[model samples]
Target: MKRLGRRGFLRMVGAAGLGWLAAACGAPPVPSPSLGSPSTPQAPLEVASPPPPSAIPSPTPTRRPLGNANVPGMYVRYFQPFYPPTREEWRLEVSGLVERPRTFRFEEIRSEMPKVTREARLKCVECWSARRTWGGFTYEALA
Candidate 1:
């Protein structure tokens, strides 16, 4: 018997692997059936009607108001200011086994770090949420 070269051996191994895979996932082929003659249609049946009521009762009289029902109309109160605090005033402090631990302002961090924008789906505990496009620096970059 002759020994196979590197390329020939690889090709034979690949072919055997494919054959094994095919055999492992093998399923019997379905046979096609011959066309038969068409059958005749049937007629629709009619439904019966329900019976009527025997005796009807007399209607009751309406009740009168108890006391004086005069009341004043109240207006709903509205507040003026609705906007939240600015992100520029936000601060984040990190402390650990490091040479320096400092508190960073939002503007300071934004100016120092290279920002990356990413699209992600945020799911709430209530099973309702939205996809948000957020811009932030990674922990490695921050470190």
Candidate 2:
């Protein structure tokens, strides 16, 4: 048997915990098909209808206003070590199978590109969600 490292063991435990959580929070179980005698037909199972749209509460953000980078809830996860670079030394590398390959400085990108803002909603499979206002220059702006 292969030995699992501390990180691997932790990841496996985390996955199992998530699986258990999902199982615990799952929808009501469906009734199994009956194997009753062919002579007697099983009665049709009735399902309860969901409440109307009006009865359901809206999930739109209202109580708290949208937040920025300095917001308390904002957090970062670095899978790898991060090293900050000086603005002058840093360059946006754009390369690959393209007609023209170029590297642009942070200052150049900021000054020359046309910027746009977009409202983005991030949702997870576990039902966790977040909304953010993202602002950046488009591909056309970079071109």
Q: Which candidate has the highest lDDT of all?
A: 2
TM-score of each: 0.37, 0.44
- Which residue pairs of candidate 2 clash? none
Model 2: worst 10 consecutive residues (lDDT sum): 63-72
Candidate 2 lDDT by residue in tens digits, 33-77: 674435554887788999999999989885444332234354555
Q: How well does candidate 1 match the true structure in TM-score terms?
A: 0.37
Displacement of residue 130 (Cα, Å) in model 2 is: 1.0
Name every residue pair that clashes in candidate 1: none
The C-alpha RMSD in Å for every predicted model, in order, reads 21.7, 17.7
**CA lDDT, every prediction?**
0.69, 0.77
* Model 1 C-alpha lDDT per residue in residues 59-86, reported as the tens digit of each score: 7776433332222232234588567658
